[model samples]
Target chain A: MYKIKVHVYLKENILDPQGKAVTNALHQLGFNEVQTVRVGKYFQLFTDNVDDIESRIKSMCQKLLVNEVIEDVDFTIENAA
Target chain B: MYKIKVHVYLKENILDPQGKAVTNALHQLGFNEVQTVRVGKYFQLFTDNVDDIESRIKSMCQKLLVNEVIEDVDFTIENAA
Candidate 1:
């Protein structure tokens, strides 16, 4: 078995209204000084052991996980068995 | 300043075409036995010190970071100053 961790986010140049909204919400909730915020996603998966997980993961990001138009994705594979 | 890592991925049970495409690409590249693959994204940001990064981060995930339609997001804040 293998454990994979995938992380996702918007491209830096892109405007993250979602991120900004959250940052504003935070200010409202009490935490100030938060200049900005960026948000993304994550996943943990168990897979049958495979070699070359990194490249494959990256390929996956490019092909499906990310919008490429606005978002980006990166993944790490760990705890292979 | 605070550093945040945001990860994003498709929600479990949601079909991950990107992940599948990547896994297939991996097999083409030589690594086999890879039954499953999932992909996501990551974002790192340096922010002016904020009082509560975790909850705020999580709130961001719920409100904006994730699609809620097909994806999910989680964030970790570290190296705060």
Candidate 2:
């Protein structure tokens, strides 16, 4: 089996309200050193070994895992223990 | 400055409905090789240099970034460009 870890985050230009709220909350909680926060999604996928796994994973991201318009995604594939 | 990346995921015993839904959707999309999916949260934090940054981050995670009851979190810190 192969393990795939995917990270999907908002585009640089996109405003992340959730992240902003977290930063503000942290500041109020006395973590004033925190300058900014960007929140995103992470996914771990387990799959059987297949030919062209990279393309398959990319297609999965493009089709359902990521929103291309407002977000960007990257992933790493590794052997599963 | 420092950049911290935090990953928060449901505990192993926890049921992840969203991830299950994604897995089902992928199967419907013909990716039957997919065995399982687990979804989680990712955070990018920018902070000023500070002593004991790792402990500070751990405190933040315990206090606000994560719910220790059902979630587990880990983070890595690095110098910011």
Candidate 3:
């Protein structure tokens, strides 16, 4: 099987409230060093097909994995077995 | 500021319902190639102090960012300018 790892993050122009909350929490917890915080998504996927995985993953990201309007997705593929 | 990127994922032994749901959806959508799927968290953190960012991040992961029992956390630090 092939292992596909996807990372999805909000675009620079978008606002992330969750990230801001975390940053505020850190500051409240005495970690004043923390400035900005943004949260994202990570996925680990196993696939039977190794051939054309890049294209397949691209399609997956475009279709179901990411919201193309607000988030950007990137991925890496590796041999699982 | 320093940009810190954190990736948190469940250990192999743990079950991920969200990943399973996504996998089932993909199969229903005709992507039967998918075998197993696991969902995780991603974070982008900005910090003013770079001198001790690594240790600070390690502490953040251990204390507030990661559960440490069921999830594993990994991170990278970069100059955010």
Best by DockQ: 2
Which portions of model 1 miss their true places by more than 4 Å?
Answer: B6-46, B50-81
Instruction: Give candidate 2's iRMS in Å, 1 decimal.
Output: 0.9
Docking model 1 quality class: acceptable
Tens digits of per-residue lDDT, candidate 2, A9-40, equal 99989999999999999999999899999999
Native-to-model Cα distance after best TM-score fit, residue A72 in candidate 3, in Å: 0.9
Residue-level lDDT of model 2, residues B1-81, one tens digit each, is 888989999998999999999999999998888999999999999987667888888999999999999999988888887
**TM-score for chain A of every candidate model?**
0.82, 0.92, 0.90
Reference contacts preserved by each model: 0.54, 0.83, 0.86
lDDT of 1: 0.69
Q: Considering summed lDDT, which 10 consecutive residues are worst modelled in model 3 chain B?
A: B47-56
**Superposed Cα deviation of residue A37, candidate 1 (Å):** 1.4
**RMSD in angstroms, all models?**
5.2, 1.2, 1.5
Tens digits of per-residue lDDT for model 1 on A1-63? 878777677888999887787777767765565677776765565677556667666765566
